[model samples]
Target: MDLSALFSLMGKVALITGASKGIGLSIAEIFAAAGAKVVISSRKQDALDEMAGQLRARGYEVTGIACNVGNMADLEDLVKKTVDLYGTIDILVNNAASNPVFGPVHDTSLEAYDKIMEVNVKAPFHLMKLCFPYLRESSNASVINISSIGGISPEPGLGIYSVSKAALISMTKVFAKEWGDHKIRVNAICPGLIKTKFSEALWSNDKIMAHMMKALAIKRVGTSEEIGAAALYLASPASSYTTGTVLTADGGFTI
Candidate 1:
């Protein structure tokens, strides 16, 4: 098998959300390195510009756009600016997510639940809808939704977030099945205990880490780059025949 041919993202246009840092940043870097024209988005323009500059310095084609995923107007503007820059999007990574409250579901207020669902679930769904026309134009379009192991098995103090992720997973399958005729592949990634700022609360806690280690076969927190590699597989031609698949990359934590 020609591995390079399978994985190369040359000439492809990729848009990644929440890409200023963490897993999103890792995915953007990897995709850019793989030859994709990468457009990274987050809530802050300064952070995006800094990251974009660093990637450009490394000889990667990258552009940064600031967007708050929770806002409908922002989502539309994000798509517009990306297409204006790159013509069309061949890959879309829905990595932006929110979990303002980290407690029991019973304690989660309606406001908190709305915020979580809006950012984690609704935003991805809306963005996909916005990108559908352009995605259908690409011969090898792929959509990756970043979910969580919490969506599969609920974790303590993260109830509403888990629910939103589960919805995202389901949304992936639904879009995959519906868009198959359009040749637009949709998939979800469920990561477990990655060592990112978004997950520092869990990994940094001695008690949580100790408990997680007992169940984790690898006995260590996964890295953002690890998840980036997984996203690469899904976005590249390597996963051309794969869609509606929930790939779990949690260092055997799910096992």
Candidate 2:
């Protein structure tokens, strides 16, 4: 079988959140390279504009929209703008998330919990709803929730953040079931210890990296591009038969 044929995303229209940098940005680049019209969103307009310009310079079709996923109005606007520009949202990658606090669960506060839930959980749900019309219209549609490996198992120090991701995973399953009739596939990617700004604390320290390596089968931190490739598979025709699945890219941390 020519496996590459299944992975092609050419002419697809993809909308990605938290796309100014890291995994989100990498996904944007990969999808664009594969000939998709990519729409990137983040809270920072300047950064999103810069990234969009850079991608356009490389001959990719791209657009940038400043969106704070926590705000329903912003999400509505994001969906409207994408549809206005491209007429449809073939793929939605819910990659925006938050980890405002660390330490034990008991030490976490109501404010922190709410904050994390608003971005990590609620926002994705809202975005899905707002984009449902466009997604339903497409012959091929996919929704990818960027969850974390912490949600799959547990991380004592990550408390509420972990809880939020767990809820996201649950949301993926529910949405997958509800949207199946529309031929829209909903799934999640639980990334392990990736070398990104969001996980600098874990991989930046040599001692922590050494300890983490012991538990990982790959014995190293994962990269954003690695996660990007995984996102590509889930978002493209490659994973046409896949849905309601949580694809883990954590370097075998769960093993």
Please write out the lDDT profile of model 2 over residues 4-56, one tens digit for every residue.
66887888899999999999999999999888899999999999999999999
Please provide TM-scores, in order, for all candidate models, with all chains considered together: 0.99, 0.97
Which pairs clash in model 2? none
Error of 1 at 137 (Å): 0.8
Which pairs clash in the backbone of model 1? none
The lDDT of each candidate is 0.96, 0.92
Query: Which regions of candidate 1 deviate over 4 angstroms?
Result: none
Model 1 TM-score is 0.99
- Model 2, position 202, has a per-residue lDDT of 72
